[model samples]
Target: MSKSEALGAVREVRLSGGTIRYRERGDGPPVVFVHGVLVNGDIWRNVVPVVADAGFRCITPDWPLGGHEVPVPEADLTPPGVAGMIGDFLERLDLRDVTLVANDTGGALTQIFVASQPERVSQVVLTPSDCFDRFFPPMFAYLSAIGRMPGAIWLLAQTIRVRALHRLPNVLGFAAKHGVPAEVVKSYAASLQRNRAIRADLGRFLRGVDKRHTLAAANKLAAFDRPVLLAWAEEDKLFPMELPRRLAAILPDATIETVGDSYTFVPEDQPRWLAERVVEFVRKHATT
Candidate 1:
């Protein structure tokens, strides 16, 4: 079956200022999956079925510009703007007591949401994502610098196919360890390679991470009272496991869960394990 077919059924929900493409199933409380950067909500296709089977309403939204070619207004697509857009999504739907499962850039946004609106968030499980001022693994400094150079984005567009990169084990050791399916890799690559909406969103999200916001989120994590689950992929080439360890120290009420055989795309690598862990974490902590 195709990946979309594997996802079972999905529906699109449009908010006042943006669109949220999500799939819903299962029978318990809500569990939303927020994917990493450059990836749409479809990345969770492998895992959502397991989540749905576990008796939870698995709600995974294609982030604005991240998937489904959703049109994001130029203004609302900015970093703070996207953050606000996330808040608006939750409020508009009145999705309370939600368990936000995020990875990569999505994970970072979850941190911001919890800090800004703790009352709305119930539990969180995050994998590799940006937290401090610098890039993960320190190698991103070069990429970030390159991406910022004049005409660099165009050069990248000309020279690189993000999909192909997804196949390189040297690129993401964790993905290799967990044996990422070629189809999933292709889907992820297709979105990154072909989606113009994501390009706009990526530019804004990257530019939005200023020095102040990084420090503020870090500080906020130190004081947050809500339960947090820090799941780090030891083989992640992008964000090293150290980042999650640092996060564990910062989040006042957090427990670290290490998954050694996955990269930033934890779901793609170990969907069943990740899904089961997420379900358990939510069941154990959602009330606190």
Candidate 2:
């Protein structure tokens, strides 16, 4: 679907730090999706409608991590800080018994949210993401380093504007096994190019990321008795495949499911597969 079509279904609400724009579909149990840095809620476009058709509501929020319409100031842009923004979004919407689905760094933020405040979430679906000490992964580790530099983020924005560079391994290259569409990559880079505040927030987020956040949540996750889904991309180059099984071992009631023919961004490469799995999982664990 086009951005205009997506905008038609978009809704915005204020939270503690700033505003979040999201797209909601269907009317059954709530399933909220969180994307990693750089991309916006658009990451779920392919998977959402598929699950929405399976009798569940899907909420895809444009988190402040990167591709957001309005960027929050430096005060509310840390990894934990943005996680709090997600918690506030949940509260502001008054959504209960939600299935929290997270991918990439969004998984880290979700872990933080669930650990700190989990009354609103009933279950979890964690896709390929930063785990344990692999906060930025080896390939993308430079992002965290570059983020600390004075003008690196600005330079990255300019470099990625070139369509060719957008798909380079350093960019979204590790996201999917196959090449991501130029238009989609364009959308993600656009936010950084046009919004200096968004770039600032991205740099801050990258600079502030620490494995302690995920490590701290790991112990807390042991206390969570709710059902958890650890869906990982088989072909992902950055995220280690072994972590999913490790996560399943840690969470009280977690199961591992492999997504074949895909990488870190499963929604892009295997949307139908992910959509089907989400619907089945939610149906089995639905509270209402």
Candidate 3:
């Protein structure tokens, strides 16, 4: 099936935070995709179909990190709170033996989630992402400062309109090696640029970002004990190999696979490779 056809229709689920929008395809073991700030499930558009076709149900949610259409105005947006939100999402859907695939900020949140609530998740696939003291990385650390200002997020949102700016280091240059498609860029930026409430949600989450959350989760990772696949990018500028190396040392059951010719956004640059790795990893560790 084509990528669009494989993803099928968009679906919604109400949580304590509000409504979450997602897409699902195929049937069998559950494999949920989590994206970082300023992007949505569309980031995994290319990878989802392959994984779903491999006989696993693929779920891609437009997490409320900046790209989502729905706003959770009353929900807690702290790092741990957002982690709890992830747990709530899994429980509300009653998904068990789940394999969470995460990238960028979503990776940090996934670490926090699995550390606190490992009951439902069976294993995980972590691509290039935040860990230890490099939560935002040095390049994007200014975002935390931007979140502190009142109108900074609005100003930041407006900058995404310039296509030329998308290739800048502060934008998406370091994320995707080949550069993101124009339509995908629009999908990632529209909600944050056009919706005030979405901006508020973004601001809250950004301001709450801290290394303490990831560090705390790291301390508990030794006990997670479940299998974890660290599919890291060889040329990742944002998150280098050392990050996953550290994770490999910490988690009792962790393995690393270096993805070549890609930056941080492996799904965007090397979707087929990532999908193949995920399928192999899941199948290798499938529970009887």
Candidate 4:
């Protein structure tokens, strides 16, 4: 079941009538990891071991438009749709007492799932996610515009020029400031390059957002009395670090942990630290 960067400790399941791909590993209580947009479950390769080693069953899924080979579903892959798919998958698996670890768009989806079906979820860990109304940074606008342009996206997919030109600076800047290893970027790039479907998936996945889901989740978060661990990167380049603070304000029982100088790829840049903190947080809150 091992394929490419995604180490296979379990069978990969392509849900019927869905574009998402999934695999489960380890043994014990279930811990499902949902990755950010444009990132496959392979993104969790470095981090999954920590959770698996901690005596918990680990499940990582290739979100639609997330993996190199997997295509993002043709249907609207909105945040709410993502939430619905996850709920459906969980129900199909009959998974009980689950812990959800989500980052970026995955985090936003997690919020929707938690709000809609709180009883099905046990604990949550959200990191470097875009779940608020904070104005998107200029880079996002640039990426969005570039991604939206058919010709630009085609050129980007055909050659390494755009990524080389656009991402290099940001990568170097992040490494220089945060001590993030260059290998992490290379690994992330490998996942990005492994398949063209990921690029295609990105085009559909990054359609901004529907504020309804965001507001609905926020309202539920404010009212829900669930234990949530809000881990945010201190040097987030895409989304502002202040978002976790806003999330904390809304979440009834939430605690914020800062990852100093990490970017959106916190798991890769600081795997050991993140693993320790996440395992600890889950241990403390999962039982209640």
Candidate 5:
């Protein structure tokens, strides 16, 4: 394990596509975290340690959702492809009865993964994520349109360079209720700035967002009979609060937990609350 400054040790796990950098703490029932576009595993920096200290192993991966250090060359980055990659990551680690916690785009990806590959996950905690018709939402629809155009990825990257844009309502606004830290903002756009290939990879993923993907996942939800907690942010305007109810309705065994003072990124705005819920679920399920 390598020291990660204030955080716990960092480790690298090589998969068929590429290497995934992750950090973990504690040693008990595994809790793997995933994030959405433009951010890395650092999005969970506030939540992971809290959950780790609660006696559950917290594995937070720097998924190739735009902020990763290295892009998986030639790897398909469509939503389905990314979900397959997540499944591969679980299989590679041989982590069993996992507690999958996700926010934003990661939450949507978990829906896809759990629907098709239910064995690896024991329970799930979703925080205001994309649902059926909300894929990318109307605010982010332009991203897909630009992605289909020539140099679309690069063009979008240039727009993101305007540091202040990160705070705009259409940008990171809907994701977080308060001001995002400057350092955290930089980290989100760093990879895209440094590597055009990675930008292209992100473009591929963004270009493919549509309702059908989440709808398909929704259709397959009944097969995943494991426990699920839809901890949606009551204040989330981008991803409506009612979507989680729809999600909870379909899952054979699922519950809705409202989170206040947070938007889509609950781990950022309400880490402690998210951690409490995660610990509660794990203790109830007792994966060990």
Candidate 6:
């Protein structure tokens, strides 16, 4: 079956800010996947089924991070606001002891989520993502500036359509080591390209991408004390190995595991390895 088919029918849930579309599969302890900017739950498409079949309920939502189909204009797109939206999602679904898995920018937002609202989450698995002072890293830091410009988001939406630009350092070049599928890239760009509201939401979030949010979250991480697995990519060009090492030091109960032959988008380059690590980690740290 196709990935979408395997993920089951699309479903919707109404949060306080807006409605979110998601795909769910399997059963057991809940596993909510959070993706980064310019992409949606499709980032975890390959990894989700494996973990789900291994006995976990995988909920892959199209988080409002530029690439999502639905737009939450009324929602707060700031770092803490997006983090609180995650908490709202959990409360709306009444999911407890959730195993939160995140990648890229989602990892940064996840850090904010678990640090602020540690009550519902039992454990966290963060793949190569933004942390510490390098929240946007030096390469794509221009995004924050672009977000502030009046029409910069629209220009970015148009610029990404050029296939040649896909390999640029600030674009998708360093996202996956090998390269992403053309069709997948198309899906990742569609919402931002066509939906003005999606662009607005993205711009608002990007404008709020200050390192202070991540720094503040890091300060509170020690108090979380939950099992955190830093599943980092060995050859990530954007976020270096030191990022995870620093996180390992700050989080009270955190460990680092390197995934070989991968870049920032581990879910794209090494889905099976990531899925296995996630399954093993969750099962090993399953709580009562």
Best by lDDT: 3
> Pairs clashing in candidate 1?
none
RMSD of each: 3.2, 1.9, 2.0, 3.5, 2.1, 1.8
lDDT scores of the candidates, listed in order: 0.67, 0.81, 0.91, 0.66, 0.82, 0.90
Instruction: Put down candidate 6 lDDT per residue, 180-265, tens digits, no spaces.
Output: 88778878888889989999999999999999999999999989899999999989999999999999989999989998899999
Clashing pairs in 5: none
Residue 177 displacement in candidate 6 (angstroms): 0.4
- At residue 248, what lDDT does model 5 achieve? 79
lDDT of 1 by residue, 115-224 (tens): 77777778888877767764333544444454356555444544345546645544444334555555655554454456555555556555555546656777877767
What TM-scores do the predictions have?
0.84, 0.95, 0.97, 0.82, 0.94, 0.97
Where's the lowest-lDDT run of ten residues in candidate 4?
A: 171-180
TM-score of 1: 0.84
lDDT (Cα, tens digit) per residue for candidate 2, span 233-285? 87788887788877888888898899788889987888888888888888887
Looking at model 5, residue 275 earns an lDDT score of 85
Error of 6 at 141 (Å): 0.6
Candidate 4 residue spans exceeding 4 A from truth? 1-7, 14-19, 135-137, 159-199, 208-212
Per-residue error (Å), model 3, residue 195: 0.6
Candidate 3 residue 163 Cα shift, in angstroms, is 0.5
In Å, residue 255's CA in model 6 sits off its true spot by: 1.2
